[model samples]
Target: MKTIKHFLIALMSIAAFTACEKDGDLITLSGLEQSELMATESTVVLTQETSAEHALSLTWTTSTLTVSDPTMLAPNVLSTTLQVSASEDFSGTIQESVESSLSHTYTVAQLNTIAKNLGATPDAATPVYFRLEASVGANMNPVYSNMITVNITTYEIDMSIGFILNSDQEATGATLYSADSDGEYVGFMGATAWYSFFLEEGDGTVWGNDAVSGTAFVTSSEDGSWNCWFPGQGGCYYVDFNTNSQNWSALWIPTLTVSGDISGELTFDRPNVKWTLPFTATSTTMTIQVSGTGNQYNNATGTDDEAAIDTPVAFAQNGSYVELVSQAGDITVTVPQAGDYTLTIDLSDPTAWTVEAVEGSEEPVVVNPNVYLPGVDDGISGNWTFDNALPLYNEENLAYAGVVNVNSLWGYTINIERDNWSDNYLLDSGDATSGTLVFQGNTNIPAPTAGLYLIDVSLNGLTYNLTALGNEIWVVGLDDQWNFNMPLTATATAGEYSGQITFAGASPWGFQIHLDSSWNRYFGGSSGSLHYRGSNITDDASLTAGTYTMTVNLIAGTYSITQ
Candidate 1:
C-alpha cells in the first residue's frame, strides 16, 4: 500500500511539471497600452549661430503590460526605436533605436541638418512627426507610442546681394562675394568691380559709415549693403562681410610667378623686331608710330615709309619699342604719306601675325592659294585620268570633298595630285574603307567597298573618309510624311546606315526602305529581319511622338529602331 501511494505521488509530480512547461511556452499579455510621447518644446527655432548646448529633448511615458501568466514574464530584452518622418504615415522615415530609453536629445545643429537632408526649404518652418516603437519576443506583437509633432524653423543668411568689390570704374564694375552669417570669406579669386552693386534695388543704408582701407564693410541701413575697396596693389585678395553686423575685412593673398618661353614673336623696328618676351596683361597686340621723309615713293601710301615682304619681317628697336619691316624679304609694304603712321601688330597667330596700318592704312594684303582634290577612281577608268576625275570642293577645314558612283564587285582607290604629277599623294597603309590613312610616297588608297559614296580627303593631315550616299537608301512611311526622299546614309562604317527620324502626327507610325532612290527594289517586313522586293509591310510595333535612331544593314537585310 505504501509503494502504491508513492507511485501516485510521482504521477502527481509529473503532471504538475508538464502543466508548468505548457504555460511557459505559450505566454500572452492580456492588456497592453501604447506609450505617450511628448516633446519638451513643440516648436524650436534653429539658426547658424545656435549651439549644441541648447538641444530639443523628447520624453515618453513607460509602456504598461498585463501578463496573463505572471510566472512566464521572466526578464526579457525589448527594443525601443524613435522614428522621425516627413509624413504622418511614417513613409520615408529615419529611426534611432536603443535597448530601453525614456528620453532622447538632439542638438539644434543636428536637427537642422536632418531637416535639410529631408528636403526642407531654408528659412522655413517644417513639421516633422516623431513616434516610438516597442518590440519584444517573436510570440509578442510590437507596440507603438502616440505620435508627436515638432515645428522646426531653420535660418539661412540672405546672400542675394551681399558683399561686393568696386574695382573697375565702370557702372557695372562691382564683383559680388557671397558671405556667411559670421561674415567669413569663401569665394573664387577673380577680378571684378564694386560699382556693380549700385545697380541693385537696396538704398545707401547698406554701406558702412566707417571705411577700413582694403577691407569690406556693411552700411547701417535697414537693408544694408556690403562693399570692399581693394588697395592700389594688383594681387588676389580675400574679402568678407558680416550681414548682421555691418563689418567687412580683406586679406591679401600672395601669388608666385613662373617664367617660361613667350609664345609668339614681336617687333618694333627693322632688324631689332623679334621680342620674344611675354606681352603685357592689357593686350596681346601692340602699336607703334613710324615717320619718314617726303618723296617716299608716290604709291598713294609712301613707298619708303611702308613696305611688305614675302618672308617674315625683321624687327628694329626704338626707345622702348620695335618696328617690323619686310625689307631684304619677299614683298615690301609702303605707307600712304610721309607723315607719322601707326602700325598695329597682332601676334596671336604665330604662323601669321597680322600687321595693319591702323592710323593710315590704304590697301588689303594677299596670301597663298589653297590645295584641292581632283577625285577618286570609279573602277571603270585608270587612276590618274583627269578627264573622268570629279573635282573636290574646298570646304576650309583642311578638307576637300566630292561624290562618285561605284559598283558592287569592283572597289576603287583615291588618287591625290597637286596641279600636276610633280607631287602625288596616296595612303601608305590601311583600307580606304575604314582605317587610318598613313600616307606613303605615291601609293594608292583602295576603297573600303563598292557603293555610291561621298569622299572627304584631308591631304596635309593624311586622313580620308568615305560615306555611302544617303540618296541611295530612302525611307518612306506615314511617320515620315511618306516622303520617298527621306533616306538613311551609311556612317563611317561600310554597310550599316543610321539616321534619326521623328514620328509626329502619324498614329502607329510605320516605314519601308527603298534601294538606290527607286521603288523598283525595296525592303519591308515585320519580323525584325527585312525582306527584299516584298509588299508594303506594316510595323507590328507602334511609334509615339519622339525621335528614334533607325539603323539598317544592307548586307544582312535587317533593321532596328531605338529611342
Candidate 2:
C-alpha cells in the first residue's frame, strides 16, 4: 500500500474507527482508504520455467469493523475486489473479485491476460498496478488500498493464447487458457466448422499446420508451424491442448449407434466421455457389429475416424469388463443366454479405452423389479417421492418398460412406492444393463449417457435393457386423426414430454403415443402406463375434452392430460 498521506486519513485512526454504537446512529466505516496492503514482491520476471509458481501475492489488513451498538456483533468486510492494471490510475485493468479472501496470487496466465489487455508486449518489461477495494457492513463507500506497482518481464509466449479461427490470419476472440499454467489449455467453441485454425501467441507468434495438408497436431517453435487441423470434424467441440506435451484433441459426437445382435443409437455424453447402448444378447456368443454416425469429429491424427467407430470397434472380454480392440483379435467370453445388457464405451482416457458390459438377468431367472418405472417426472433435480409408482403385473411375459430421464448429473432407478427403499424395491445395479440385478440395491442405475432412455426389464428373465429415445414423439388417435399427427414437443429435460390436444367431439376419449413421424413404432396402454403396440388407451372413466394439456414422461412411460 502507498503511504497513508495521500488517503487524507491516518492509518492509526483504524484502531478507533468504530461508530458511536448507538441504535439510531449510522454504522459508518472510517474512510475510503483505511488499510495498508503489502505485496510479497515488487520486481518479478515471468518465464515458462516459473509459470507454475506465483509471480507475486497481494495481501491487506482487514477493514475497520462496523457495529450498530456495543452489544451487537461487528463483522469486517468479508469480500475484496483485486484490481490489476497497466495504467497507474487503473482505468485499463480487469476486475476480479474474491469473497472471504484477503489475498490474491498472480499466475503466469492471469498476468499474461492482463498484459495483453494493458497493451504490454510479451517479453517486454512493464509496470503492472494492483489495488484492493472492499465494503464493510452498511458502508455505502468501498475502502480501497493504495495502488502498488510491480515491474514484471512478461513471458515470451502469452500463457493465454487464441486461435486464428477457420479462415482468419489474425487471432479471433477465441482465447484458450491453461488452468495450472502447466501447459494444458482447454476451451469450448462452437463453429459451423472447426477443421482448420492457427494458434496465435500474445507476441504475434504464429503456430499452425505442418505439410501434408496439416493433418497432425504437431507444433513446435520451429519451421514446420503456422496453421493446422485442430483435430475435429466440426460442431461445438471441447478442445484441450498442452504446450508441454505438444498434443491436442477436439471431440464432439452428438449420437452413437450399435447394430447386429444389439441395435439402436444413444446420445453421446461428451463431458462423461461415454455413450451407451442397451440390447439383449441372442445367444452365449454375439458380435457387436456397427459404427457411430451423425454429427461428430476427432482431430487427433490417424484417429479422425475414431468419431465414427471405424468399423473395427470390436470389444473383447478383459477380466471384469470388456475393451475395444482390433476386430481380428476380438475375443469372446461366456455371455448369459439371452442376457439383457447396457453396453458402455468410455473414452475419457483415449488410451486404455474400455467397453464395459453391465449385464442384467437372463430368461427363467425369475427376478422381478417392484415397479416397472419409478422416477421423478420433473427429473432428478428434486426430491423424488415414488408416489403412484407403477408395478410390473405382466406375469405371463414378465416384461416391464418405461422411459427414464436421468437429467444431466444423476441416474435412474426402478422401485415402488413405500415408506422404505429396501422393502419397496427389489433390485438395481447403478448402471447395470445385463448382469444379475442386485436384490433391493439402493444404488441407482446410471444411464450410460445422462438423458432419456427406454428401460425394458423382464421379471422371469431378470434382465433389463435401456434404449435411447429421441424427443420427437407424437400423440395419435386424438382429433380423429390416428396418422403420424399432433407433435408432443420435448421439454428442455429429456424424456419428460409436453403438448396440447383438442377433441372436436365427445367425453371419454383415447390416444396413442408415436415414437416418431412413422407408424413403424407406437405405444398403447392404460391407467397411466404405456405398452408397445398393445391396445388403445381409452380407460378414462370421465373425459370431456375441449383443449387439454398432454404431459408424458417416456422415461417413466407415463402420461396425463387435463385442462
> How many clashes in each structure?
48, 20
What tens digits encode model 1's per-residue C-alpha lDDT throughout 1-563? Answer: 43443343334322221112242343333334577898998888886544234558889876554344453332233457788887888887575556366888886556766666666777778998888887544445668899988888865533333333232211232233332323332321222111122211111123432321112233333333223332222222333444445544333323211122112322222111111222323233333322211111111221112321112223343333333343211222234444433344432222233434344423222111223333444354444344323232221233444445544223333444435544445666667564445433555566545566655566556777666655347778745466665668777654567887666644233457766554444555443555443323344235567777888765444678788
What lDDT is obtained when candidate 2 is compared to the true structure? 0.55
Candidate 1 to truth, TM: 0.25
Model 1 stretches with alpha carbons more than 4 Å out: 1-26, 29-32, 65-73, 138-141, 157-563
Cα RMSDs of all predictions?
Answer: 24.9, 18.8
Candidate 2 per-residue C-alpha lDDT over 276-330 given as tens digits, one digit per residue, 9 for 90 to 100: 6666676777555434333323344332443433222344556654544344233
